[model samples]
Target: MSPTTPHQPVLLRLLHSAIALLVFGSLLTGFMVYDRYDKRFGTLNLPIVPNTQGIHGTIALTFLILLPIFAVYCFHIGDRRLVQSQSMQQLGQQLTEVGKPIWWVSLQRLTNTFMLIAATLAVVTGRMMQEIWLPTGELNHIWYIGHLISWIIMAIGIALHLLMSTKVGGLPLLLSIYHWRIRESDLPKNWLKGFKIKPNSSIALIIEFVVIGGIALAFLLPLFVTA
Candidate 1:
């Protein structure tokens, strides 16, 4: 009999869906915002979007709100899917050699880690931006540039992520993340009882806290600043 494909945990799937939806939504609206306001690179033939900045900001804000939870889960419960201590060493191995499986797995882990880093950069820099900066023709702000670069990186990272996943696990593995079936132990009600969330490594714990804390600070900074 053929082996059943492994399924991702329900929490990861839900968070992933929410974050991915908002990321793409933000990216689309962000392009519209750029098209309507700044065209330093070049302009698309698109028409002006009404309040595109507002729509982009709203989508990005929703992504920010959900990001911390997802970061925590990936760092803790799903750390295996992220780059490990020996990831570099694994990468040093030849793909055509004996460690082909480990090399590919390590590459996938690195891609996931890269995407998470890109997402965080996009979110934090985005939070630092003033909506008026673009519309007022003040487009050279460091934060805005950072945000745009991060957006590009995240878009590329997402593409690489999908490509690597297909390379490693094929269609079934790609579809596993969207599966709706839930295991009993992974149910939300069983969380506290099971303490299912445990950091796989101290570095992951630190990275998770730093990401969540940094994002939390980004939101609170504007509330206190008089300028």
Candidate 2:
């Protein structure tokens, strides 16, 4: 494929699209829920929606469900696109003046990692939340606070992600993630054909396990805890 006609794995596109759409849906419905019930800061001039909380919760659950699989892909299959051990060193070198795509690529990798981490935070906190907590006038819960902050972080992260992508790979790279036509090399069967841990991939594996473990605990903890 040519530079402008960039190619991406079909799986990556599906995961990316699903996660992005679900996340934005969650954000919208979440805000509506907040606007309807917990308006500590301010309120929008929108009509109250009775099922906003339910809608938000559903979207969040869906996002959480797909998160682990996507995490695995990022940590292993797409590790090259994430922040590397020398990412800071690379970013540090070009902090003063912008010169090459190298620095921007490093920044983009770091942003991708951050987005994953931040999304995990959102998921865990959201799962920990009670559907009735906000509606019942209890807004100071730690999990709710974390989820709220995560929403803001995700909004900012999205902007940085876009800026970094545009800076590093330009329009072709930006469009690559959305490109539907997959190359023969991107076939799903080819992904796992002889797939094995790369040298020094232990760190990625560890991090992936940690995130997945946290997600599992988030869902399982509520079962053991009282309310």
Task: Give the per-residue Cα lDDT of candidate 1 at 40.
Answer: 80
Candidate 2, residues 1-227, lDDT tens digits: the string is 23775677777888889988998998899889878878887999579887878888888888888988888777767788887877777778844645566787888988998888788888877878888788689999988899899998998899999998888778898898888886787787776543446623555566666677877876787788654
Q: Pick by TM-score: which candidate is best?
A: 2
Cα-based TM-score, every candidate: 0.88, 0.90
For model 1, the stretches where C-alpha displacement exceeds 4 angstroms are: 1-4, 94-99, 191-198, 202-206, 224-227
Q: Residue 87 lDDT in model 1?
A: 77
